[model samples]
Target chain A: MSKRNASESTLAHDTWAVEARGLVKQFGDNRAVDGVDLTVRAGTIYGVLGPNGAGKTTTIRMLATLLRPDAGWARIFGYDVVKEPQIVRQLIGVTGQYASVDESLSATENLIIFSRLLGLGRAEAKRKAAELLEEFGLTEAAKRPLKNFSGGMRRRLDLAASLIAQPPLIFLDEPTTGLDPRTRAQMWDTIRRLVKTGSTVLLTTQYLDEADQLADRIAVIDRGRVVAEGTVDELKLSVGTSSLQLRVQSPTDMDRARQMVDQVLGVKSVVSPEAGKITASMANADQVTDLLIRLREARIHLAEMSVQKPSLDEVFLTITVHGVKERESAAVEDEHELEVTRV
Target chain B: MSNVSITPEIRRSLKNHTSLSQSVRNSFTMAYRGLLKIRRTPEQLFDVTFQPIIFTLMFTYIFGGAVSGNVYNYLPIIIPGNLVQTVITTSIVTGVQLREDMDKGVFDRFKSLPIARIAPLAGALLADTVRYTIATVLTFAMGYIMGYRPNGGFGHVVLAGILVIVCSWAVSWIFAFFGVIARTASSVQGISMLILFPLTFLSNAYVPVDTMPKWLQWFVHANPISHLVSAVRDMVNTSAFGGSDLVISLVGAAIIVALFAPLTVRAYMRRT
Candidate 1:
């Protein structure tokens, strides 16, 4: 393969893998991406977490130089995304949620074409394609057209294609959004390995646990804005140390049980509109032991109860002063999180 | 190979400096990718194949006796005309396929690469030349089977084929521009046919311009396809390569390329 010298002409903003300020994109009257800013350190996996309409994809598109921002500026390894896009293009690789590999071509052909476009020699391109398919466990399907490949297989091949020359910064938008459990775990390993090998990664995901597992830091976006940004622990602490969810045995006894819960746990609870389930955040997880005893002594029977990390819904509740209408919408979004296709 | 690992510590900031020569090479590589797609699905060539054979047979027998007094006498005139008409009309596929290709997510990957922005579009247009060549050779072969012989040597016939291919390649750019801007593949085809039908049918492809009314004759002569057909006829019939008709067609092709190539590239860049 032919290698070109690293241009000394690049600017001094190379320390950070990505830096952006006031990035905005509008489609018609709706601003898909509002004035948003982000900074990603090198050799780290940064996650942008949000609901389905949170503009995470739009922000990544702007940073990858795929879409021009209507306003704002971004730089990739010291190159302006707009003014020095050619340099930016060289430094970044983007694997979108939709498989960007050609559907008509086989997996091997897709990799080779991507490699050849990056200036690899013919034989080297072939070798690289084979190696990637092998690494991605796609060697058996290398000669089959992408249309015949399953969703998990397509995702792996998509990631493989972007890693052809292994660009310094890779933007993986919802890389594991639609995969089965096994495939999801495989993708996580691949992403972790990418960072471990010295490539910085920026990934967007809707699943909170995905962000918790992979991201060193997470940015929670909602309705085209970053509502919260920090390490996952910081976000968890902001929501509360622990989440308490309980269902009462008798719907009529919910009020007494809620009162007992408030008196013992010292925290107000929000009753779900159905099933007499009460959700509350706790300052100290130890308070759960006291609340349970109070419920038992009141002769208030319980259907079920558990204390765990808060769902994304509770996080939205704590972070934003959303109205009842907005909160209902966020609850509706949580319903979607349960029905993973498991494909 | 089964033990392959992807954890190599690749140079994170591998600068890809694409010189003009590298851009050209990238375009050709894209063209090779186009050819590979064709190899996987050879049905894509059915248009170029069936159009030439079926159109040549149907047009020659149906129009020969009335237009030229006999089928035998009409071969030379009809063959060159059919070659020009079939290939120029076939150029519309370039734009249609381009629109379809861009609609897929694959082009997003292409746009993110450091190669020339125009490479994929240019490569697609270049690959369509092979389609034009297939139409040209098939039309000539079908004509020979139907008892037509070119007085001009095979060299001139090949030259005529090259001329028609060049012009059609240029005509494809206008359609490629449509492909870039039009929202759907069907719409690109719709708009291209709207523009091409009148131009191809009004030209002197199926009949002599003198047979039309005075007003119609002027338009037929002015039609760009007419200039191309007459140029091909000059080469195949009288072995005349230096005629003003050939110059007009070549210059027209050059002008179309100069105008639409960059225009299409600009539109493509904006969208991509």
Candidate 2:
């Protein structure tokens, strides 16, 4: 941790670090970001998670004042993104998916340029550049051109460049996309340190684990709209029930295991696959003991049996796939009922 | 949702949000950063330093005898012509650097920055002026070394140098626009040269356009490069100041900046 703080002189005190309503962005004929509504608190990590081509980048661009939304409005740190962009610019710093620093310039020079652009005096810019180089552990390479820095070093320098003036709100769009695991961890630690100092961050990433680790709240966007938004545990609960899997020693005993599971659950629909595995959805967690007893009485030698909950990947698949199917069938039923009514 | 476009509200509101002066200031800052990049790499100096030396020597030796009957006789003509050629050739760096920056994700980074959207594009053009000036001075110095005497002396030489620098700076916007829109850096260079070479070569640069075929003469006479070269020749070779060439050069510069500046800025702003 750099122990570097955004002093009153460097910080822009503002409320509501970011806010957006019905924001939309399009590229050519494709709606890259559909209508999105988001509100991030003053000093928290608001993580936007989505699959590739899910409009995360487009939404971020609109919020950062990089792209103009086709519809609706957005504001950052209490300033309307379209109407008060200069004030918005002064209050925020952005670290993009790729390193944006000039490779031809030394790391120190890169930071100094940013510092000057941020309106720092020449000496102040120099001092701030040195401070950033030290904080990012790039002091030794400060005088060397960024082209010679390794990937991880360049990314760190890129991040350091963004923090030169220590704006109150910072936008990081896939900041760790191409970094290695170790480098990614280092970058995450840096971000954690930033939050500790009360800087708000709007992070867009495809990595679910990253959201789980860092985000105070997560918004999962798909097809340009937020499909779900909640804490991790809350999202996991949306699937409705946990699943239990039992592996019997012999494939031939699968039918017997299925019968036992059906008897214990009082549901004739329990499934037993040819691989000697029995899986059942358990709405009541208290049935574990009865299920075990039934398995023992069936004389099925078990290799392994465990209770497990759905993961984020499973939750995502269920929502996108099953939810869509459920909607389609519901529409079909409504059409059928409408025909019946007309008849 | 599929048939999408930037709404009129966004366009109208962008003007309200982003001011022209602020954009120009942002553009200048970006250009200053580019100037810092040139300071760091310095290896980009090969063209400015080496080209002036080679072209000055080669043209003076190769064309001097056939045209002026002696190398010394051609000094006054060859020096100014080579200076114009070298500086203009150096303008190719505008597109090349822009392409390189775009390739290296610099523009992607710029898109996220909240500054004026045109800053990066404008800054890139600003930074290459340093390179053009270096070529201008070096070519003149090399000419001085080759025993070329300008009838216009030091003051006129300085004016001519400033003139070439300004013209090249304006010319660079054309290349900068190419850099922004071109798919690759090599292609920007190729395309810029495809437009530059014939204009410089066929003009009254190395020889009088009057001695050629009527068709060739007309093309040469109307070429902007001819105005620029004639402007330089009047200043350096004859110790005279003419308003016509200066007007042509300034008008040409104004037209290029007018046409490309807004187009480039608009395209650049829409990129994100």
Candidate 3:
């Protein structure tokens, strides 16, 4: 009890905090995460950026050893996630996209249970629970059951629970999703503080700006694959600063819509035939006004349109050149029957 | 929404050389958590507290005169019967609570920890003994209030109580397996009651077997619930410490646990 395992105590600086290769996980007929690869240097924040149902949580689950990969492999601090999980468990902490603390227990009790489970002495566990609750600004509600806490308070307690053991590598899965801006900013500060103190952090988020604010590197995942990976500047330059997606009212107008998009944006665009839509990368989002005006003048009668900040459905179309070609030539499988609910 | 199902993680691939002491400590900690839940809610004890008293009083009066010609004469037969029935029904709560506890997010946190895999399950099963004891004590007290006296003496009465509580704990493992495997908490309740109702009602727990038609009597006498009830009667009424029924009851409880504990753990481990 007085000594620690050598492997658990030693964390070499040169080791990558996270290394994953061609990882895959499938649920039913859905390959939620297909062939994702990532590498993060120690002492840096890595962001897995994706939109809803983009498999961000699934990939994080596999990395955290909560879900087994269908294929490929991952290692945390050079320990194989599958083969050396007990070692990996000792080396990492995980905070899920949802609050993981016991809802029926008070904030203090939840933290104490988590601490005791991690082998802390009973008195030490109690002290740590009180310390963390106060630090998270939850001291006032420490005695109240978690069911009484608000969303932000619950999320704070969730992170506080993860920090008890302070494992070398921490997984924060969308730590700020659904939070108010002030709370989100506070979470960001807390995350930055963790990395500053020598812990390597990996977070998943849907906001590109969040990645820009926190991550040293960002992986843009779409439909179960990493479409782009680099610093924020490099990814933005390659995927186009912003992109646009326009779905027409009818499928027959898709070809003509693509032509108008190419003429207005002055860039080639890809046609997603079944969706009756066209997607194009733009130098700036301000250029969207010109394209919309031109389509109106040409009487394209668009059903729906929007310029997006490289959302999950748009990232792969623009980042992967071969993916563009494949979609452009693929046969139209289904006609769009989208009810034009909006005028 | 982070709805993670049980995914097989190479079957504890992150193997730590967990000493028996650490496993025991982990189990005690988890059990403590279970006890905290009981204390916090307190209402969770309502079934065990109220159901036994209701059954003991209801069954003694309702069937007492019809079965044995008077209420006092029926007290001896019905006390043990209601004891077995009340405590066994309480065992089903173990499975129901376990199912309700496994919200994927909380379960994910549990799985990510390095403690012994069985701690949470074992702790939940152990904490349920509190419920069993409550039901056992209440049933006996209700019998005492209704004028039933045990010639087997206070020691054997206590022995009878321990035997039922122990058997209920063993029976709970069967429900614990259902908890891990069922898709919903309500389904666990439905399936547990489906299995328990017939087993309890059709046995000698509530009725004399000879009065039943011959076809039903065959199944009722062979029912394991009957063996448990008979064992309790032997201990309380006759002070027969080592009857064949007692051996059968003990062995039956052992077999139930041995068969269901691993089966439950296996189903829980299938994180696909």
Top of the candidates by DockQ: 1
Ranking by TM-score: 1, 2, 3
As a whole number from 0 to 100, the lDDT of residue A301 in candidate 3 is: 85
What is the DockQ score, from 0 to 1, of model 3?
Answer: 0.21
In angstroms, how far off is A266's CA in candidate 2? Answer: 5.3
lDDT of each: 0.85, 0.78, 0.82
Specify the CAPRI tier of model 1.
acceptable
Per-chain TM-score of chain B, candidate 1? 0.93
Per-residue lDDT, model 1, residue B201, is 90
TM-score of chain B of each: 0.93, 0.90, 0.92
Best by lDDT: 1
Q: What share of the true interface contacts does candidate 1 keep?
A: 0.53
Q: Compared with the true structure, what per-residue lDDT tens digits does model 1 show for residues B203-263?
A: 9999988889999999998888898899999998889888889999999999999999999
lDDT of 3 by residue, A243-303 (tens): 7888988777778878888987889998877777788877766778887887788777888
Model 2 Cα lDDT, one tens digit per residue, B167-267: 89888888878887888888998999999998789888798666799999989888998888888989987878866997899889889889988887776
